[model samples]
Target: MISRSDWLRDWQLVTRTALLILALTGTVAYAGSQVPIGKPPGESEPVPATMRGRFAGFVATLQFDNEAWTDAFVLAPDRRWFAEYARDATNIRVKDLRSGVTLRRLRTGGRKISGLAVSSDSRIVRAVDEDGKPLAWTVATGKSVSSEAEAEGINRIDHLTIHRWDNDISEPPGPTANPGQLISRFLASHGLSEQLPDLQTIEQVTTSVDGRYVAITEGYLGHLTIRDLSNSSAPVTIEWPEDWCGHYLASFAFDGHYVVLGTHGDEGDHAFTDAAAFEIKNGKAKALWHAECSVDRDAPEQISRDARFYAIGAAPNGPVVVWDLRAARRAAHFEGVYVAPIISADGSTFAVTKAASKGRRMLVLRHGKRRRLDANIEADPTGPIEDGVYALSSNGRYFAARIASATPGGKNAVGVWDTDSARQIRTIEPGGDAANSWKIAELSNTGDIILLADKSVFKAGRWIDVTEADESLLRGRSDSQLTPDNKHALIKQDLFLASFTLREIATGKTIWSLQGTPDLGFVMSFPDGRVRISPGAEKYLKLVRGFAVKPFDANAKRQFLRH
Candidate 1:
């Protein structure tokens, strides 16, 4: 992903690239205006307001006359979108960009203002809060399905919530922002399975890697259950520990046998805190460990002292600590790094940084000493350099981080660095001392492209073509699904699935864009919210990228982590 300054970037280049692919082969646009390495998207302004600039293309946002309640929004692949909760102390309204409408008088149940997530189709919406609770409501009367709405070829409103909320139960604090149209929130609130009545509060919920099974903790009935999502209803349930904390349900072992739970440790993580570990097998949960932590389980003070969220790598390399649930011992610890970024298809690697002073390192862990990689990077990460690095491609080739310094009175873009040479490759968009650091949300498998986002949904960041290489995609839509080979792309859009069409390699014209009426496609949307369409990846590059962080929280209710 091309990192941007704290300024919210928009979705353009990727959309352009996708358009290029969907069109046909050999359709390339020549560049006229050159956005330099240090050029800000615009000149200085007193505050963070949306404006039209030469480089800031197609900016869109929903703002009230006198309100500071701004939350980021996401546009679905097919154009539907969802807004993060816009808050003041009292009134909470979500806006739709398409019709310039807001969900006034929303019939929501919870007041805690925890989180809100929208599905790609926008048919179903899930709401939750900090305390890991659930809220049900219909925000839109014009184009939304209620929890009880039912229809043919359309998802049952009942099944939609269970499935939608289940995935969101453990929002991982950030958007996935992959080229693929997958979104997850940490506090997804899934409905319970059968065979056990009188269910109360569910502590945690986690879906298996394959999207086959979902493990959830029900605090009310004192049981742990694994639901075979293959069938939404009648899911199987496992037993549980009497005093388990749902907040601690993050993840399990690779083999899926030993479940990792916090323990009553000698250190501060135990003694008084609610953090604990558990081992689940044969449909039961056994308490194994316990530790104290802040609400997010992140250790703000010190690691040996009271660290909550786990980090394995230092700044550029690793502080990563592999956990062995069965042995209940620390596996391997790479000191300098905090977390290993997703690697490329061939097992080439990248890392994330938690530091902010000097430039962080990006190196290849080839058998031993760091072998810094050198590759072409399109744009840098957006934001403060001190916040450290975010999304990196699979190969230890390039990195994205907040732009450290800025030319006065200008916006800022992320800084792309040559991990091998420890030199600045380029500075993307720049502006504002008020810029929120960009989040490294999108990454491609072939290490060809990436996406970056900030606090604003008005603009998104996409780095297309290349500053130094022939990385242009030949064909494919941003919404197109990747063929198994990753070399080709299939552009199919719509809700009912059949309404979607497939486009071939680049020529900048649609090979096929399926026609669908609202009924044939059956798309769910931002429940009468606003959304915009943008370009995605290109097909010309002939590459594929897939990445995921290791599951560290067995007690993971990822819902709490969603942004």
Candidate 2:
């Protein structure tokens, strides 16, 4: 009925139609592949399972069933272990991050604990109860020991305080504690005498960054002993001159080659404190230049990352003096007293909150000039400014401060200021008096501020609410933080079932997650590529060490800086 040419053309048309339909279906499948799994209905499109597994390297070290609450948590210096003591618990539990195993359980005599400190090797945990009694226990044996100062007290007022030098040093003083009894008992109980420091006189003990050298201050004004733990010879003891009343090792040089010590005593009828540096190789001490200024006994001094500069809040209500360690001279001084002075790693910039003429203000000193931050905020003030607490970013790009409200009956607000332009870029009020004097938990290296906004943990610039219910379930939630690269944020979020999520900071997309208590504290990352998290058990923690990959898209990476 039809010609042969006509029939062939008809067949070709049907085949072409079929091919076009197949191509469209293939394109749709590829688009769906980009969606991520477990995304909320309205959050965004999902990321493909392929891409999620691309960065799959999270290894869980410990898993246990334990409830988490507001507790005193401390991570060891080496990032190998951590300790958690709950407010209502009777025992302090220590766990190893690498193995997720209980290292020790130090019993507290039904006393409320106020603070905690851990030794470098995770072998010792010192805790102070509500009654001012400090007890030290060996991690392996859980054998408790007390110093003379801790044993006998008048109002039971023991003047001993557990001090942490920088982030790496946590040395609780056994000052008047019997070293013979403490070390012998620990050695005999653990059968590891050769692995411990065999020395007396622990006015203060600080370990080097590499854990190779141990510096111990004998009496308040006594000699300092630096023992090379790897070497068998006698430890190097550097005696302080007779006039010095108190001598304490402040910090170690970045290269771990020098130690800085502070000396305080009556110098010519006036009490004074000066700092000096000792080269570990030569065992010789060099005195750094003093500011002719008195140091605050309560507030700790701020040291630069390189140990080349020291900013001492010259007595309360005095100007902050910046000392140059390399030149051993006074570099510069500010006009107002600093409650907390922050120094950049390079020693090129300094930030502090000082008393202003009208109210408290924050100032950053750099390039021999001072830039005022509070005056440049964008808010319309209806009243005078009030007190504020500020935290600086690691790169000196931005600073976040929770300043008291300037309007009648208004709540306090948190503002982020740009250090480069010296202006407020963003401001957020968490809607309550609870925002007043908000304690900054952790500021990521990339300038993201993780702080306590009201009762919830606010990340970057937004409030992370996980449920329709109240926030009573999130009571003990500490601050969250971004990894060093800023690509991923470890935020405590409710998976609707008590869990945590590692969201990509740029895209707001969660890359890794686990089911656990919201009361998790991120311990430091180790060189071996392990990331540790606290609250491993109800009272313990687990270490997560795996792939350190960035899963941010190009657009997401740009957004991290935009905000």
lDDT of 2 by residue, 1-563 (tens): 66786477445433433322322222111233432212321121122222123333322232332222213345565555556553345567655533335444466644556656676676676766676666676655555655334522211112122222212223354443333444344223433345445444344554443344555555554566666655555556565544443334442211234343344333232233323334445545443222122322323245554444556554345566566644535676776555456776567778766555554677888766778886433222222222224566656677777655556777776677777778888766665445554556444445666655445556545565434222322323222333434344444322112233455433445444433221212222221222332212222232222212232334322322111
Query: Candidate 1: lDDT of 136?
Result: 37
Error of 2 at 31 (Å): 43
Question: Over 4 Å off in model 2, which ranges?
Answer: 1-297, 305-308, 335-339, 375-388, 406-408, 442-447, 453-455, 465-563
TM-score of each: 0.27, 0.31
Worst 10 residues of 1 by lDDT: 537-546
RMSD of each: 22.6, 21.9
Error of 1 at 4 (Å): 27
Best by lDDT: 2
Over 35-126, each residue of candidate 1 has an lDDT whose tens digit, in order, gives 11110111111111221232112111212211221222222223322333333211234333233233332333223444444444654444
Clashes of 2: 7
lDDT of each: 0.32, 0.45
